[model samples]
Target: MRKAVLLALFSLGFISCVSVKNLPQNPSPYISKIDLVKGVKQEGERIVPVPFKGKIGENPVIFLILKNAEGKNRVKFRLYAGKTLREEYEISFGKPGEYYSRVIIWQGLKARKKGTYTLAIFLNESLLAIKKFRIEGLRQGP
Candidate 1:
């Protein structure tokens, strides 16, 4: 009876090991901070960033603050205008295990249709964050 129990236990352990080995392992990317802000000048000196409130038009900015990002990671930043892609940016991380931040700004956009727009950020093909803002009033010409 003792030998039978031992053999069964051994077989169970072996099966567990094999199952674990066969399971797919993927590393999860971590983001500490993300904000969609509008760019405004303070006293005409420097631009200050503030959180978006579903309203923006002239100058829009997306802030991506990251932590624990390591090793050759590709990050994609995209801006969309009512289901149409406006701009895209891809940033690459060269070193491993570091913290970094990036701010993307759209300067002097000409006559965008008054509607809601989307800003999406992706890390390694996974969407990490998204934000939306709306432009009111008529389209301002360039």
Candidate 2:
């Protein structure tokens, strides 16, 4: 009986440590390119998260690429889905500056059923840019 219990615990530990395979949620939301005119560029876009789509219940991760001119920058990006959906993505730009993000269900809500979803990228708390994306049944490969 003790051996069986140990085996069960071992299996559970291994399962928890196993990495989950998710798809890139598409269109690759990113900085794309920055046309810096002397100062740090305040321009950004919501690119489709590439190479992964993810499962229905799986929490989606987001990545942001910040661009600056002349020097590094301390900037942030805000995301909004609905009244209860919100995330503030903070970033500091350096070489290969990539910010990681995730999507969570608020008020038992999923983006697909919520109709239109909006993600607003802000520079210093003011609106710099906004991007729109749709949630459909087509998921990225796991």
Candidate 3:
């Protein structure tokens, strides 16, 4: 009975390690941080900064902030525009020194049709995080 229970536990652990299909294609890419922010706004006496609050579809812009320290930071993004991954962009992120390469997605983008879209972030060929957002009308009279 002990051996049977051990085998079952081992099998469960192994099964949980199934591969993530949507991860990056590279093996060495390192991602330090990823954040989803609302539209950029100008704080008093300061330059443009990420807004603190806004709904996903209500905001005028969305920021995909990727950060890394090593030289192998990379980005592979799939923009699901309806029923499939209609748009994809692969970008090589620069080595983290003074800036985190920020990928900005503008709302009301003619390319971004209205529907539910998901943004996936990968690190070192592993699925690090996934952010889901909806694209709606732009903030009027901005």
Candidate 4:
């Protein structure tokens, strides 16, 4: 019938418009969880998670869990002391196969100042996650 045809076309157009608006802005891998840990240990091709408080000492480690990560990708971590950019670290992945889930660990970062610090994680130049922590009882030597 003519009425059925018009209703079908209307539904199709409405569905297409809704889907277009729901599309993700960034097609890069998604980070499911981010954690600040003291250190990481490797065991049989896996990085073991370590316990950590919101406050850290000299060296700080960052742990990230990502999903839908495939092919070559770059991850960057920016550390800020208060509002000042303190350190930046980058990691590159060049794997052939697709990784549905991946674990990344970044270490060897030394916290120099004693105050609030913010860690920003970027996936292929896009901001993915952010975390804040504090450092106390830090002794500065002259």
Highest TM-score: which candidate? 4
Q: Which has the higher TM-score value, candidate number 2 or candidate number 3?
A: 3
**Ranking of models by lDDT:** 4, 1, 3, 2
C-alpha positional error of residue 40 in candidate 2 after TM-score superposition, expressed in Å: 24
TM-score of each: 0.53, 0.36, 0.45, 0.69
Please identify which of the two predictions, 1 or 3, would achieve the higher lDDT against the true structure.
Answer: 1
Greater-lDDT candidate between 2 and 4? 4
Candidate ranking (TM-score, best to worst): 4, 1, 3, 2
Candidate 2 lDDT tens digits, 1-142: 9999999999998889977688655432335432211112223653333323333222233344443222334455455565445666566543345433332111111233533455666554556566555454434588
* lDDT of each residue in 1-142, candidate 3, tens digit only: 9999999999998988887779764433244444445445557854353654555544323344343334545555555655577655555645545443343322321234456777655554567566676766555575
**Highest lDDT against the true fold, candidate:** 4
Q: C-alpha displacement of 105 in model 3, angstroms? A: 12
The regions of model 1 sitting more than 4 angstroms off are 1-27, 40-54, 96-112, 137-142
For residue 70, model 1's alpha carbon misses the true position, in angstroms, by 1.0
Query: RMSD (Cα, Å) of candidate 2?
Result: 18.9
Clashes per model (N, Cα, C within 3 A) = 0, 15, 0, 0
RMSD to the hidden true structure, all candidates: 9.4, 18.9, 10.5, 7.2
In model 1, residue pairs whose N, Cα or C atoms come closer than 3 Å (at least 3 residues apart or on different chains), thus clashing, are none
Prediction 2 global C-alpha lDDT: 0.44
Clashing pairs in 3: none
